[model samples]
Target: MVRNEQRKLTATYLNGVGMAVLGVGGFAPVVSMTLSGPTSSIVPVLVFGCILASSGLHLLARQTLGGLEE
Candidate 1:
């Protein structure tokens, strides 16, 4: 139905966003810091990235599982 299609589309978007954030916000900073020497605390960046990635994944999972009330 249209609802299911919408869910799939939303899930796809969420997945893409999660992957992008994981790469740019999470791993990219860690890699950059390791290669160039950290001038600031990497913990905050890692934590922030992880939170964002996990949130995105969580939303994607919910949509993929098909939940209109969730």
Candidate 2:
């Protein structure tokens, strides 16, 4: 049971990292495009990307604290 819990925790931690990476990846293109010119249409995508990154970071922080407590 202890080993199983550890495995689950590891999985959750990795998932949070992966989500954060994906969020940054999603934003990269939008940032590049914006550097060149106006990006009126991609505003929603940009917002989504920011939200995803913040949420992922939040998840990661929570998991980290939980792990440290354990």
Candidate 3:
């Protein structure tokens, strides 16, 4: 049980880190570039899509890990 808990915690931590990295990588550049010049309309759309996709991936990982624990 302790081992299982540790594994779950590790997975959750990794997921959070991945989400943070993805969020920053996806949006930071667009925000910086937009301030310098006209931003492409698609840039925001793509960044938002990346955020949604990353969130979905994180949820999926959690669900899969939960299933493994069961």
Candidate 4:
């Protein structure tokens, strides 16, 4: 069905974006920590990374959940 194909397409794009952001977010905290050292200031960077990664995860979850959400 077209709807099913659309879902697959959407899911594929979502997964690509999700994984991309997740990879970037996963490295951000480490890069920040390595460059800046462990400090309260790093908390913001870590939080930013966490937020990005969480958003990516949400997208991935949506991709996995598929039509259940629609």
Candidate 4 residues 1-70, lDDT tens each?
Answer: 7777777777777776766665566666667778978766666676577667768666775865467433
Model 1 residue-pair collision total: 0
Q: If the candidates were sorted by their lDDT against the true structure, best first, what order would they fall in?
A: 1, 3, 4, 2
CA deviation > 4 Å runs, candidate 2: 1-39
Q: Which numbered prediction scores highest in TM-score against the true structure?
A: 1
Q: Best candidate, lDDT-wise?
A: 1
Query: What is the lDDT of every predicted structure here?
Result: 0.73, 0.66, 0.72, 0.68
Candidate 3 global CA lDDT score: 0.72
RMSD (CA, Å), candidate 3 to true, equals: 3.3
What is the per-residue lDDT of model 1 for residues 5-49, given as tens digits with 9 covering 90 to 100? Answer: 777778777777777777777777778778988768866667586
TM-score of 2: 0.42
Candidate 1 lDDT score at position 45: 68
Deviation (Å) of 52 in candidate 4: 5.6
Give the residue spans of candidate 1 off by over 4 A.
46-53, 68-70
List, residue by residue over 1-70, the lDDT tens digit for candidate 3.
7768776877787688658757685778577777897567777777777777777768766874774554
User: For candidate 1, what's the RMSD?
Assistant: 3.7
lDDT of 3 at 49: 76
